[model samples]
Each structure stands twice: as C-alpha cells, then as structure tokens.
Target chain A: MSDEKITPLIMPKWGLSMKEGKLSDWLIEEGTNIAVGDEIMEVETDKIANVVEAADPGLLRRRVATAGETYPVRALLGVLASEDISDADVDAFIEAFEMPVIEDDDDAEAAPLYEFAETSVGRLRYAVRGNEGPVVLLIHGFGGDLDNWLFNIDALATSAKVYALDLPGHGQSTKQLAGADLSGLATAVLAFMDTVGVESAHLVGHSVGGGVAATMAFDAPDRVLSLSLISSAGLGREINSQYIDGFVNSVSRRELKPVLINLFADSKLVSRSLIDDLLKYKRIDGVQGALESLSAALFADGEQKTILTEKISSLDVKTLVVWGAVDEIIPASHAQSLENADVQVIQGAGHMVQMEQASQVNDLIKEHIAG
Target chain B: MARTLSFKDAVNEAIDQEMTRDPTVIMMGEDIVGGTGSPGEADAWGGVLGVTKGLYAKHGDRLMDTPLSESAYIGAAIGAATCGLRPIAELMFLDFLGVCFDQMYNQAAKFRYMFGGKAETPVTIRAMVGGGFRAAAQHSQMLTPIITHVPGLKVVCPSNAYDAKGLLIQSIRDNDPVIFCEHKNLYAHEVDVPEESYAIPFGEANIAREGTDATIVAYGLMVHRATEAAENLAKDGIDCEVIDLRTLSPIDMDTVYESVESTGRLICVDEANPRCSIASDVTASVTQEIFSSLKAAPQLVTAPHTPVPFSPVLEDLYIPSAEQVADAVRKTMAT
Candidate 1:
C-alpha cells in the first residue's frame, strides 16, 4: 500500500507553449514489464510528435487515458506498479488520482519560462532552471532558439543548473550578430556566461552550437568544465550543405517544411506549428541577413569552415560526443573524430537526436557532467 | 519580440516604421491629423479611429491633412509616387472609391503599364472597409472587388494584426500601387505582431487552420467567420481547413487548389455582396482550374445582392455569419 511503489505516467510538457497533447497511440500493452527509456506511448503536440520514454521502470498495470484523446500537462496517462499490487488497489489508485491544478499567478512568480540577458552580444533571450549545483549552458544550432532543449532542460535541471540561450540572429534574441563565424559565436557565448556571472561550467551544444562550444574550450579551456556535442558541426568537413542553404533561402511555409524534414529521422515529427514558428522567426527583419551571413561564413561552398578534432583531441577537458545514427545533416561517422571523448551514436534518430531521444541524451549528459 | 497588437495599432506601426526608415514616405488624408489648423491640439484625431494618432508628432510636416476632395489628393499622391516619393494616401472609406475612381484606376493603376515600364507608382492607399460598425451603406462597404478588378493595382485585405502590419509594410515598399483594405470591424482585434518591420510577400495565402474534411477560403473579416464555422463543424466530426487569402489581385489560388485537392470540398466566404465578390471569384477559379478535384459543388457564403443595412439587427444579419458558413460546410459534408 506504499504510494512509492506505484509510478504514474503523466503527460509530459514538451515546450513552453505546450499545454496539452493528444495520446496518439500507446506503444506498449498493459501488464508489460517497463524499463527506463523504453518507448511506451506516442504523444502528438501542436509543435511536434514524439514518443514518451519511460522515466521509471515498473510493471504496467493500467492504461488510464484513452488513445486519440488529448490530456493536459501532468494528466495521468497510465499507472505502473509491482506484481504485488492488486487489481483493486490499482483501480482505486486510478480513481483517486487528481489532475494537477495549474495556478497561473503562482507559476508566474515561481518559474518564468524565459528571461533576457544583456550580454556584449546585445540583448539575448534565455531560459534558466535549477537553483543549485554546477551551471550547464545549452546553446542551440543555427536557425534554432533556446526551445531546442525543451525536452532536455527540465530533466537536466533536476541535477544541475541549466541555462539554454538563443544565439544572436536566433529565437527572441537580438537579430544583430557580433560575428558570423564560429569564433564570433564562441565569443558571444563567453560574453553571455560573463554577464550571467558563470565563471566556468559544462557546455552542451547542438549542431553549429557544438562548434561554438568547441571553439570556446579551445580558446579558453579553463572556462569549460566539460563539453557535450550532439550531432555537432566542426567535427568533419562534410555536412549537408543542402539543409544549410535550404534553411537560409526558404521563405514560405511550403518552401521551409521540406527543408526541415531533413532534420529528423522521422519526418512526421516536423509538425505544422514547427514550420509556422520557424517561418515567423525567419520573417523577422534581420533574421534572413543574419542566417545568410552565418551560412556563408561557417559553411561556405558546402564544407565546414572550422575543424577542431585535432585541437579538441589535444584538450584535457572531459567531452561527450553524441550523434543520431541516421543523422542526415552531419554524418554520424563524425562522432568518431573525437577519439579522446566518449562517443554515443544513438539509433532511430536524425540530426535532432537530442529531441528524438531526449531521455537517453539527458542520461548521458548527466553521467558525463557528474563523472 | 512579438507582442499582441490591435489591427489598428499594427497599421499605425507599419506606416510609422516605414516613414522612419524612408524620409520620402508621406501620409495625406482628411482628418488623418484632425485639428490641423484649429486652436486645439494639432495632431488631434489621428485618423477617424486614431490608427494614425501619434504619427503627426513624430513626423510633423510629413503627415498632411488635405481638403475633402479625394480625387485631388489621390491624384497628388500618385504623382508624388512616380517622382521618387512613397506616399500613403488614406481614403477614409473604401466606398468613396466612386469619387476617386479615375485617379486610382486610370492614373495610378495604369501608370506602369501605359508608360511601358518607365513609370512606377509606389503609392499605397489605405482605406477602412467591411460593414460591422453600423456605419451605414456608405461608410462601411467592402469595395475590394472594384479596386481588385483593375489590372495594375495590387489589392491587400489582412485578416489579423500580424498580417495587417506585414502586408501594410509590403504595400508601402512595393513598386506598384497597392490598395490596402483595412476592415473596420477588425481594428480592435489583436494578434501577435513582431515589433521589427517585416514584409509578407504578395500572393501568399496563409492557412489559418489545417484540417481534411473540407476547405474554407476567406479573406479580411470573413476569415474569422470561416474559422469559427470550422470550429463549430468539428463538433459534428467534420474537419475544415481555413485559408486566409491575404491578398486578392494576384491571389494565391495555388494554396486554395492544394487544400481543395485533399479535402475534396470548398466553401468561399466573403463579407461583400454575392455577385462579382471575392467568394464568386474564388468559386469560379476553383471550378475552372481544379473542377475534378472537388467532390461537391463549391459554395459561396456572402452578403445578399444589396447595400449594407443601416439598422443594427439587419446589418448583423446582412453580413455573412458563422452560422451561415457552418450551414454551407454542412451542405458540403452532406454531399
């Protein structure tokens, strides 16, 4: 009868604006033995569609939420318990479970979803979570904002102070760029850390953000505790220039949707809202020029301009290189470039590996930083 | 950087930003700077509804108050546009197009074509259109069909605040004369609009809501009606895709065709009177281009062939309602 024995699977909040999601399908059947990180159900949000990975391992007792019906954030979708728990006890538990009441006033005061930081790079928009422990900065890739870590930030914040920021010319940050190359972006990140009063911390970067993180570690090794690069740039010379160019040129939703499909292994994950959000960002006055300049400076002629494998391998900083096995943007083979770092090539994911396999990525990062 | 802005504020901000960016941009209209020569505040009524309320203070001499003559002022604006000046002439009500018809259709619209590409009229005429404020038949009329019928002029009617701002900026920067129709009822309606100036390209139809059961095409304030109808239809297990044709002339028929191809049903909603209205134009185009794609005959939900009523109750019923649009959708579903 201990409450700790029952693990309730609640609907997850994927992003800042995601209030509810439809339980599209249940991947696992009732009474199945669940393991950590096992795909249990598929949830479809307006922004994207992703599978819900098990956070707690237990025997699946009951499926409470119906498939194809939407449930609010933190609504109990299912229950998992040990074999000792009876059917009546499980039924009673399901009947008694109450949905968490969302208090708008209290939640606003407790945790603001996003914040603004006035760094040397100009006004930068960022999201901060966790109150204690070592700081972890999450830098998104080109044309991406802080929300790229929507699935990973809260999970990592459980153990470490996590901050995800929009790089210049991305997200809600100032569209003006300090510089377009890796060194320029790296300098902006350092300025952000300095402004936020973070002396040294772990740096987690995705795509071009990975290049910026590496550049930071190379330029100022003492400032970086560790580095986690997921499907990152600057590892090899070959990249999907088509995606880079396509992202820079596409203006309309029809034109941009196909370009975004290349970013995921499951193209279905690129929902309508995702394309609409990107279009809204792209339509901002300076965003197009900023993205075009960055594309030319970083990936001109479809080749990576900055290669840091030799330099990163020489550094003594702890590094974890993770890549989606079927990453189309940057080949998963690039994960092998950093011989000194821990490399993990995840299967069934594309360029957006951190989002496609969020729990696994979060686990790897936690263990890497803690080690 | 995106914040909620009323359609009125969005239009004001677009003109303000464009004026700040280019010194040549000027605004001239009756009462745009209300109390121009009076003993009271100079920039008094910044347009009839204050859409241009504070512009006079910022760009003092640039915003001019003209005589009540629409023909004289519109002609002057067109002339100024051809001579390197970008002028946004406000025609208080679109129904007044009858008074300034020759200047708009003959002069500005044909300048580029008649001059064999030598002349370019980068003038924007901003006017309030549609009937929901009980402004009677004259003050409130959707005369978009008249201006859109002209070959050289670009016609834009935005549905929400975001599109209002972007399309207005585009209209100002465009090389051709653009008749920017601002719906009177949508002035108070708010949506997220970026503070920074951005131009939405012409001929791009925004799919406001995505669905599969049927396709509902609308423009201006009727877009809200169509979306409402779609939501109501959803309760009956019907899904409707609503497309907002942001611009009329050089309209985005491709987006409409794409939606109808999948949904196999079409409903065109326009606040204007039925004959030669945007609804009829869209229905005719859909029938001509992709007739086989439609599983059912296209429906046009529009005002009856009469002037907008002056009475409150009659006016409310005269304009196409969400219920009427839902009824049309139901008919399509039945087919």
Candidate 2:
C-alpha cells in the first residue's frame, strides 16, 4: 500500500504443460528502466526455448531469481518498482514475495480447458479460450490437431474469443468422416459451430483446413465474417504428390525425416519431437483411412480438387490469403489466385508459416481481424 | 493441447495406438475383456483394475480375454512372437510371473541369442508391480531385479503417465522381449500427456530433479519419494539430483556416473528389498567403475528383506519414505 508502484515479474507459462522454466540469462540489468513487451530474459522450457517479454513497465529494482536456475510458474523471477522506492523497501518486497499458490486439482476442475462436443459428424474435440469478443474459429489441416494453432491461439485470444478444433478425421475427434469431400467437411464445421453455440465466427484455416474454410464460406456466406487461409489447398491444382505419398506411407523416423523436411524452408525446424508427434498421430487407429479418404477426395493424382479461387473472388466476405513463399506442399504461386483478396507471400517459410514466423503471422492476423 | 491423463489411460492408449499402427499387434489377458464368454457386455471388466478398459470397443476382437491360465497364454504369446504377430500379454500381477518364467526367460528371452541372431521375439509382457493398496504378499512384490538379471529381457517401470505412454510405445516397437512393469500405486497419478503418439527410447534415464551436492538414483514409485526427499534436502542447503532409471536392463549408468562424479556423493532408493535390489546393483556398479571419485560410501535406501505386510501401519513402514531418503543423504554428507 505504499506510494511507490511494485510489480512482481513471475515466471511465464509458455505452453499448457510448462510447469517451470530455466532462466538462462537476463537481457536487462538491475536499475534499468524497462517497458512492457521488452525482451527481459531468456527462459527455456522442456519443449522449446524462447525469450520472456516483460508484461509490466517499471524500474528493474532487483533480480530475485538467479540465472542458470529453474523456477516454477508464478514464482517471482524479478521485482520491478518505481525509482521512489528505497533499497530497504526493495529488499522487503523481495523477502515478502510468495509464489502464487496453484491448487492444481481445483484449477483443472474449475474450468474445462479442452472440451468435447457431440456433433452430427462425430464426437469432435475442441479447445475454447477467451471470454467475450468477435469469435474466431481455428481449423487445422490434414492430420493436425488443435495444437497446430498452439503459437497463434494465445496471441489472438488477447483481443478476441478463439476456438481451435479437431475435425472428425483427425486428433482426438472421432475418425469417422461421413463425406470425403469438402462439402461434407464443411458440414462438420457448421455442426461444430451449432454444437458449441458459435452462431458465426471468423475462420482461420491452414492447408486442407483452408479448403474447408473456403467451402464453408461458399456454402454459408452470412455465417462467416472473414476468411484467412494459410497455405490453402483449393487455390491451386499443382501439389507435391511425392510428399503426400511419402507422408501416407512413411512409418519409421528414418523415412519420415526426409518427408517432413519438405514442409519447412529451414530443414532444422523439422525437429525430432515434431516428427515424433506426427508419427504418433499417424499411428492412431483411423488416421490412415481418414488421411487416405481426404487425400483421394482433395488431392487426386497429385492435383487439387474443389478450386474456390473464382468463387472466393466473387464472394462478399473479407479475405486474406497467406502462403509461405517456399512452401513445398502447395506452391506459394497459388496465393495469386485470390483475385480481390489481400495476399501475403512470406519469405523463407515453407508450409508452416504460422508456426515458422509466429510473431509476424500473429501481428498480421490481429490486424486483419481488427480491420 | 496436452491433457492430464492417468497412468492407466496412458498405458491403454499406448497399446490401443500401437495395435492400430501394426496389424500384427494383439492383446490377451485374463478378464481383459471381462465378459469374454458370458452373455453380458463384450468388454466387461478389461483386466482386474480395468487398465485395458474401452480398448475392446475400438480394436474389437484384437483385445482378447484369455482363460485363467497364465502359463498357457504366456507361452502362446511367446510362440506368436517367433512367428510375426506382436502380442501384448498382461501377466495380471508380476507376482504371477512365477507360473510363466520358462516361457519368458528360456523361450522368448533366449530365442534371438540361441539362434545366432536369426530369431526375433518382439513381445511385450505388461504386469502390475509394487504394493500400496494393502494387496498383501502375493500381489505386492517389486521383482524387477529377477527380470533384469536375465540377459535378453528389457525391463521398464515408469513413474508417471507421460513416461508410461512413451516407454510402452518403445517396448511394443522393440525387437526384443520387454517386461513392462506398471506400479499399482501410480495408476491414478496424472501428468500432461500428448494426444499424439510418441516413443521414448530405452536406456536413457530421466533427471527428475537437478542439483549439485548429491545424486539420488531411483525408479518407479521411489522416484516420487526421491523427488520429495530432494525438496526437503534443498531446504537444508543439501541440493540432491534425483534420477529416474526408466529402464533397468539397459540402465543409463553414464548419466548416474556423470552426476556422481560431479557431486562425489550417491544415494540409491528402491522399492525392492535391500538384497540384490536395484539400489545395491547401482551402488556396486558406480563404486567399481569410479572408485577414486567417491567421497563417501554409497548409501542404499530400500525396504527390508520381508514380505509386504497386510496391515496398514506396517504397509506404511514397508515403503521407503522421503524422510529415510533425506536422512541417508545427510549421512552421506557427514561421511
């Protein structure tokens, strides 16, 4: 209750499972003034390493946690205060700091983070976050889960209500696909919206999901507020047939390693964990059949079906088409087909532009949605 | 997003996912599909504790409910492995391994070696090990040492759900016979497990806690106890690194050796009885390999040489507590 402002810079929770993080190094020194969003430290979690940005603006009074040490989430890493605070007061603040007691059992049961909704298609699994705003639905591509939007969901959630879903044939969702084509898949999306009570939502789609989103817009124009397609499938006819064949057939890490390299401009981004994750998805009971059905219906003989370029140009919805310039799955040249849509060809990115350049893509998405 | 999954669900998911991936994979156990011959539901009881519950719905007849004979089904599972089918036979309780030891050790375990590497037995025998539920002597022994002593068998006892899932996947995929032990007490212990399938390689020990003063090596339920002890030790400024030896046969002694060499102190905690247990085995190896680096005699914290008591109070005393581990660490520091 003092006149001087105090801020406790706690350890950030990057992902859902990140319980603690190793504070590798501090970017700023003590007594230095810092602004919000400034990179203050480098924190490494078990999954990935990233910089921790300051969420509060103040004078860096004291460093509470040492570098080269790991601290649990909500544990005070540093103390930020106004310059009017004395050294004794800063010491007292540091001494009195207590970690936010996380009653995990209660926290977990209080709000269901990941939920399942029984749709007409199947029992579809989805993750709903954010309270109130313009609702945005994130649809993953072929063989991907709600996790494909891991980097984007939290970022977009700051300004709008975000929902990322696993379609009928993928993730933890039921593997039964009633119709193999885009029309059937679009109906599943509509069914999910109806079940979740999302009357209308701005749609963000990647790869095959992009095709579904476009079809969804075409089928029900009034329901979709806008459309953002990332490396979408329906925009072009030319596809890497070898990649599709390799993905479907490759079982071991050795065979899949080369196949995954095709998705990223930087081959190093195809991490062992990434390949392992995909292999796990591939191993699930109905994943193979679903992939086969989707592949046959959408990309037959390495050629694209359900091209919506002409239809999208005539449509009234606000559209933004984003593609990785070096995308090997679907060529970046396909981004040009959207006649009146704002198109972006991100450089040095492959099929996973959203994940490759997350911050930039997030900024673009935020701007597009707000506009 | 990763979901909080129970150890039982994780094991079930691993088997279910593996069976889906490989056509040759099959599951067999007594009451695994409870009402196998009865007129009631097909997947009635799914094993004693329902570890294989709901798997029958997706995999259908692949999840077989065998007769009450362990030796017969266990032998058949071993024989099926020599052919092409990858069979996952649940021993019900590891205490029942006595009935089928010949099939596991002599046949499945030795087939590859005796045949000059011509034979491959890719079989996984999953059994519930360790005691906590007042299951008494017959149901409660941690016989990891017996399985680990055999040359051809791969032994794995996971502490948490995530490891349970990954290690089970690796065991199923491996060409050698694997004795995958799941602790009954940790069945309900939850952890963030990925929905997607993944495999954790064998022989790599997971660092449960990292510290500088001492190294505590443990597996299964003892890992949790070691972690608790490490926390209490930290308060007394005695930082202890707790390592989980996920696999017993191909134990990652290198990680343990590195940590012990750095700290010059070692403490081994095992739920198994003191004599010929994992604790004594690890202590002997580390001491023999790196004798000069030792600042003190390696301490072993394990249950006494007696049957797991049925009484609640005696059972509480049967398992090695965090207090005992912390005291052992203090003794090492004093030495």
Candidate 3:
C-alpha cells in the first residue's frame, strides 16, 4: 500500500448528497511527517465540519489544494512524499495526477442505496454491505434508519457483512405497522434476516434498537453470535424526557434541529443537511405517530419499560457495550450495567457515541468481531 | 373473510389490506379514530360514518387521528410522502377540504414537477363526496371536477364498492398524490371485496352496462343511476352503454371516444352542478378529439347550475336521476 512515493490527498466525501467541498484549512505544514490516518487538513462541506484525515503515509510535499478553494470530489488537494524523493518527482506526480473520473451519482442511478425485498413481513427496505464472515445487523433507534449507519458501514464492512435496516414504519420500508412494538419490530428484523438467508448475525444497535437486539438475543440465542450496544435503552431505567418529547412534537427544521443536536458531542455536526435529512424522515407519512405511540409503548413513563439487561447474562453471546461521556439522551452510566459485557466510554461524545468518535468506536467494534 | 362488506367496511378493508401489504402505506384524518383524548371508547367512531373502523386497533398509531387542524396535518402528510411514507389522510367530508386544500393543490400536487423530478409525494387524500343523505350542500356536493383539473394529483371518484375498494387501495399505493372522492350515500351500499390487496390503475373506464345506441359517461354514485337508466332503456327498445369514468384526472377519454365512435352518440351524467362539471369537461374533450365521430350534439345529464337544495324533494331532483339520464340518452339516440 505504501509503494506510492508521492501521496495524493483527495477531497473526501462525507454524507450521501455531498458533491464537493472547500479546502477550508491546512492543519499541517510542508515537510511534516504525514502518517497514515493523521489529520492532514480541514475540509468543509455544507453538511458538517469535520477534520480530513490522511489515507496514506509520506512526507508532506506540494500543497496543490489551497485554503478556502473549492473542488469536486477526488480532486487532487495536495501531495506528500518521502524525504528521499526529490521536489522534481513531486512536480511530476502533481502534473500527472488527473482527477480520476469518479463514478458516483450517475452510476448509482441504476443501483440505489435502498432495496425492497418481499419478505413474510411484507416488502422491507434494507441496505446491505460486505461479502464475507458472519453478518452484522445494525438496527437504528426510534425514528432512525439505515442512513444512521452511514459513518460505521464502510469501516465494519471490511471484515464481515453489515446490514442497516429500516424497521416497519421507518425509512423506505412500509409504514403500515398494524402490530407495532418491541416484539413486532423484532419479528420484522428476524423475518428480514431469514429472507436474506443469514443463519447468524451479530446484532449492533442504538437506543430502542438495543432493546430489540436484546429481545432477539434472549428469545433466540442461537441466531445471534455477538452483541454491541451503543447508548442502548435496555440497560437503564431513566430515559431523557426532552429528547422523546422534542422528537414527537417537533415538525419544522427550527423545532427539530435542537432536538437532533442533543445526539452528538459537538452540536456543530448537527448541520442543516443533517436536520433536513431527519425532518425529511419525520415528515414521511406515518413516522410521527409511529414514533409517538412507540415511545409511549416502549418508554411509557420516561423510563425503560422493558429492562432486559438481566436476560443478557443468560444468553451465550460475546457482548460489548460503549457510551459517550457527554451523552444527554442516554446516560453513559448505563455502560457499566452490562454484567458480563466489555464496556468502553468514549470521551467528548454524546448519545450517538459511534458517530461522534467514529474511529475509536469503529476500532472497538472491529476488535470485538476479530476476537 | 370474503363476506359481503358494507361500502364503509369495504373502504376500511381496502386501507387495512393495503397497509398490511405495503409498509410504506399509512393513514391520517380527524376522527378517523373518533376518541383521541375523550374518555369514551378508543376508536369511538371510525370516521364520521365509520368507514375506518377497526384499523386503529389493528394498526396502532399508524392510523392517526389528526387535530381539527387539517392544513397542518394534510401538509405534513404531503411533506411526508416526499420523504418515503405513502400516507392516506382522510379529509372526513369533501366539504372539509376547504380548510386544507392549498396543501393538496400547491404542495403535494406540484412537488414532483417543481422539484424537477427529484421528489415524489405519494399521498392519498380520501374524503366522502356526492349528495343523497339529506346532508345539505356542505356535507354533500360531488366536487370531483375541481380536483380533476389539477395536473399532478390523480382524482378518483368510484361509483360502487368493488371499484371503491380496488381504486382506494391503488390510491394508497400509487407513487403520485391522489384525491379519492367517495359518495357519502354509498356507505351503506354492499359489495363483495377481495381480502387480498390489488390496484385499479387510472385512465381505465369500467363499462357498467353495454349497449349500441348511445354511451352515457358517469362517476361516483351517479354511475349507479346511469346503470339504472340503462336498465329502464333496456326494458324499452333502446340499448344504452353506461361508462363509469372512475378516475377523473386521467379521464379515460379513449374509452369514451371508442364507445362514442361505435354508438355515434354520447350523454354525460354527473352529480356536480352543470357549469364546468365532469359532464361539461367530457363534452369538451369529446368535441375536440372526435367531433367527426359524433352523429348528434352531446347531451349532458347533470343537476342545474345551482347549489344543492335543502328540501328532500328538491335535493332528490337536484341529483341527476335515472329518468333524466334516460331522457338525455334518448335525445342522443334520436339524433
């Protein structure tokens, strides 16, 4: 992987709709040791403010991508090279680096991110990734969808199959939820897995999805190989009343943005695009009432109505729990409540611990799956 | 399961079955679930006349009982359709659309073309239409022609329970926003509705009764009246073809033209007022497309250009009757 003496720093793609971004700032100067995965520069898209990390290692060389200058995705931003490589070599590499014709949107028109499979539960919408190893199903919390795993899917897909599904009444899946609750959601997930022919899968969940995953593990231990709960709801009694209330009541962007911001450590990540994305989801025909009644049913009294933490010990599955220190929605203290599970506390993260510090959380997930 | 269901029950079964069949489908309306906050029964009244009964209990919150605010909820449902949910929001009665029609005409109907094909508002706004129950102008009045004028919105006014069930289910599942006008008087009418969910696409007209002399085009409750007129004409020597224009927006003019071309005559029967009614629209379309095919001037059988009267006798005469339809068909046959 390190054969390239001249490293190409390309414009990074964040969320689904991002077409281009501005080279906002350069965090490092030339001649610095540009290690792999180091924060090389600061790129800004309309969606969020995130530090662009290096994908390869070399010495920082020519800075073709200037500060505050905008470029389309994969446009050559800068270059890095070894100390032994001469400046002439860097110039040749920069001149030769033609922006590769990145096949993105046009290519995707024929194949979409959303797919509907005729399941026993009806046509369910789900996103699948990876091709090898035991499948891992990433079930989002209340009012969440497959897009919630946009940050985690690429990292986890390297070792195993990763599936992000929209439970009935959520995402592109059908909204006709006649029998809706934790069990109903679990039934849909199990039916989807069976339809997709997954004998066993590691269940990775957030919030309410955590309850569904736990229920599945308790009900059918044979089908679940492992469990990863991030800011899960099943372990504790207390639930944030404001998050629940805001999610149910808020309909407009002005009303919903603050509520969505509560999920992250850095509220700035709650960009207009993020708010717009969530509002788009909430505006979907049946989502509001679905989330409302589901909240009342699952979190009836501002507390975890179904405490299945005790059931986790009975199931013979490798379980890992993680939490964000600054989490406002679900208390980080719940991370220690898993009696026989490995626990990690991510600093400066909120209820959405995985997204706030994706690299660290992804490392922990990979380690658990590798073990 | 396949028992003869009332028209109200047929509508419920359509929504219920479609919701069960497609997870993207959802329903919303005021009092569609009667008791939201009241201490009475949970689903006190499944719609004003009980068309949506038993769905709330089975579907839970997916069957939403909106606030008296139709504009906000209708707009929200329209907005939601663009995101992903195929929402079916009941407007209670056709009269209530006045409080919340801007969302239908400006937002839901125009989202796709306005967004340059980036959006799709697959919403279904269902409301009880047509006059007959002594429920005066406000509660009655077949307003199908009004919605039919819009380009993006698909307007469907089914005459009988079978068409009602299939067309309604299709409306809920269709990828375009739809306006479903149900005749209030037909609620008690009975028909055998299939348990399985299916769709009846727009632009397809149903031949209620076939004849060779003249073609009578109609919709909603009036389709039944047209058939009754055709039956009476059958008793006589006249053979009349009754064409039910189930969907108004994508008007099945081809069916009308084909029948008109064969019969060489046309008589349109509509419950709406005579001025700019479905009858008038059909006549205009026919004249423009197949003026040469016509043997005689098209006769429109519809109520006079006036509001629905309060008196039972006046109201009875106000609706296009079987005798009037027969007379209109006779006029076309004579020429």
Return the TM-score for each candidate structure.
0.96, 0.66, 0.54
Residue-level lDDT for A279 in candidate 3: 56
Answer with 1 or 3, whichever has the higher lDDT.
1
Q: For candidate 3, lDDT tens digit of each residue in B207-278?
A: 777679999999888888999999888767788888888899888888899899999898999888888888
Q: TM-score of the candidate numbered 2?
A: 0.66
Cα lDDT, model 3, residue B22: 80
Interface RMSD of every candidate?
1.1, 6.8, 15.9
Docking class for candidate 3: incorrect
User: For candidate 2, lDDT tens digit of each residue in A97-210?
Assistant: 777654364475555657889988888989887887789999988767787786688778888999999988887888799688888889999999999898899999999899
Task: Please give the C-alpha DockQ score of model 1.
Answer: 0.71
- List, residue by residue over A241-331, the lDDT tens digit for candidate 1: 9998989998887888889999999999998888888988888889999999999999999999889999998999999999999999999
Highest-scoring model, DockQ: 1
Question: Which residue runs does candidate 1 get wrong by more than 4 Å?
Answer: A28-33, A59-62, A81-95, A101-110, B36-39
Clash pairs, model 3 backbone: A65-A77, A174-B23, A174-B24, A175-B23, A175-B24, A178-B59, A283-B80
TM-score of 3: 0.54
Question: What is candidate 1's lDDT per residue for B1-335, written digit by digit as tens?
Answer: 77789999999999999999999999999989965565588888998888999999999999999999999999999999999999999998999998898999998899888888999999999999999898998898888888888899999999999999999999999999999999989999998898888889899899999999999999999999999999888878899999999999879999999999999999999988888988899999999999999999999999998898999999999999999999999998887
What's the candidate order when arranged by decreasing lDDT?
Answer: 1, 2, 3
What share of the reference contacts survives in each candidate?
0.67, 0.13, 0.00
> What are the candidates' individual DockQ scores?
0.71, 0.14, 0.02
